[model samples]
Target: MTVGYILGYDPDTLREIVDPEQCAERLDEIGEQRSLPALLERVWLLKVLGRLDEALVLAEQAVRVARMGGTRKDLLRARVLHATILQNRGAFAAAIQELTTCAEEAEGQNWPLLAAFAYQHRGKVSYDAEDFVTARTDFKRALFLRQEGGAPEDQLESTLLAVDAAERRSRSSIAS
Candidate 1:
C-alpha cells in the first residue's frame, strides 16, 4: 500500500516509465490481497495514464470489495475514482452524480480536501455540460477549500484556471 501510494503520488514520473498494463496487473494482484489502499492508488494511477476503461473496471471491483468488507471509506474512494473514470470516458452526467455523492460523503467526514477535489471535478463536469453558473459556484468552493487547506501553488493555479474558465463561459453567455 505504501509503495502504491508513493507511485500513485508521483504519477507524472511513474507515467513516464511504468507501463499501464504493468500497473493494472499490480492493481489486480493488490486487489486479490484485499489491500484497499493499494487498489485505490492503482486506480488513480490508471486514470492518470488515460486507461479509463481499465480504471473503471478496477474501480468497480474495488467498490465490490469494499462493500463485501464493509469498508465505507474504501467504498467512497472507489466511487469517486469510478466517477473520474466515467468523466474521462465522457460520461459527464454520471461523473457529476458520482462526484456529488463523494462531496456529500466527504463533507460528512469533515474531509475538506476530499470534498474540495469532488467539488472541483463536479465543477468540471458542469462546465462540460455548459452550466457555467453552477460550475463557477462549485469551482469557487473548491478554490476556497484548496486555499484554506494550503494546497501547493500548482493546485491553486489549476483551481484558478477552472474558476477563470467558468467565469469566461458565464460572461460569454451574457454577451450572447
Candidate 2:
C-alpha cells in the first residue's frame, strides 16, 4: 500500500463497478496530474482486463511523473508498480531485474517498506515462474522487513502471501 498516491474517487465506490473499463475511463477523463494515482489504478485494471499495451503505457507515464517531482520513496514505489505490470505480463526475468534494483535502492536509502514491497513482488514473480525456493526466501525476507517496520496492515498482507509461498514450496519440495 506504499503506492505513494491516492485517487480522487472513493475506493469502495470504484470497486463496486462491475466493469473496470468504466472506472478507468472516468479516471482518464480527470486529465490532471493529481490524477496520477487514478491513472496508476487504471493501469492495474487494464492489466486485469488484458489490455497489456495500455497498461505498459500508463505504467511508463507513472514512472516518468514520479521521477519528475516525487520523493525518493515515490520514485521507488512507482518503479515497483512498473515492475508489477511487467510481472503480470509474464515478463518474470525483467520483473525480477527491476525489483532487484528497486529493492537494493530502497534498502540503501533506508526505506524498508519499499524494499519489502519490492521483495514481495519479486517473490510473486518467482512463484509464478515456479522457482519455489527463491519465492520462499523472498517472501520470508519481505515478511521480516514488514514486521520490523511495524506496518501492521502490510505485515498482514505479506504474511498471507508468505503462507501461500510456503505452501507452494512445501508441495514443490515433495514433488522434487
Candidate 3:
C-alpha cells in the first residue's frame, strides 16, 4: 500500500508498476489489514484497468468508510475520488457538485492543496463540457493555488489543461 500510494499519484510511475495484476492480487490478500486505503487502491487499480463501474463502487465504499470516523481531510479525498468516478461516468453536473463541495470544504479549512485539487478537477469537468472559458478560470485558479501549496506536477497538469482551454477558446472565437 505504501508503494502503491507513492506510485499511484504519478501516471508515469503508476504505469511502471510491475505486473499490475500481481499487485492487485497481493493487495486483496492484505487488504483486510487496512480497509480504507486498500479499498482506495482497488478503486485506482480498477480505474487503471478501465473498469470504471467497479472503480465507482469502490470509490463510494471508500467515501462511506471515510465518513465512519475518518478525518475531514480524509473524507475530502474520498469525495474527490467519488467525484472523479462520477465525472468518468459522464455525470458532469453531479461531479461538479461534488467538486464544489470539496472546494468549499477545502477553502473553509484553508487547505490550499485540496482547494487546488478541487479546482483542477472542476476545470477538467468544465473542459469536458467544452466550457473552455470556465475551464480556463478554474485551471488558472488551480495553477495559482498549486503554486502556493501543491506539488509541481499539479501546476504542470493544470497548466496543460489551461493550454487546452486556451486553444478551445481560440478555436471557438475563430468559428465565431
Overall lDDT per candidate, in order of appearance: 0.74, 0.71, 0.73
Please give, for residues 6-37, the per-residue lDDT of candidate 2 as tens digits.
Answer: 22222211111235556456546654444557
Best by lDDT: 1
Model 1 stretches with alpha carbons more than 4 Å out: 1-34, 68-71
C-alpha RMSD by candidate, in order: 5.4, 5.9, 4.5
The residue pairs found clashing in candidate 3 are: none
lDDT, residue 128, candidate 3: 68
lDDT of 1 by residue, 46-123 (tens): 776777887788888878877788466667777877887787788998899889988998888877777887898888
lDDT per residue for candidate 3 within 43-145, as digits (tens), equals 7666655678978988988999999968999899889878878877889999999999998899889998888879888877777676767777887777777
The TM-score values for the models, in the order shown, are 0.71, 0.76, 0.76
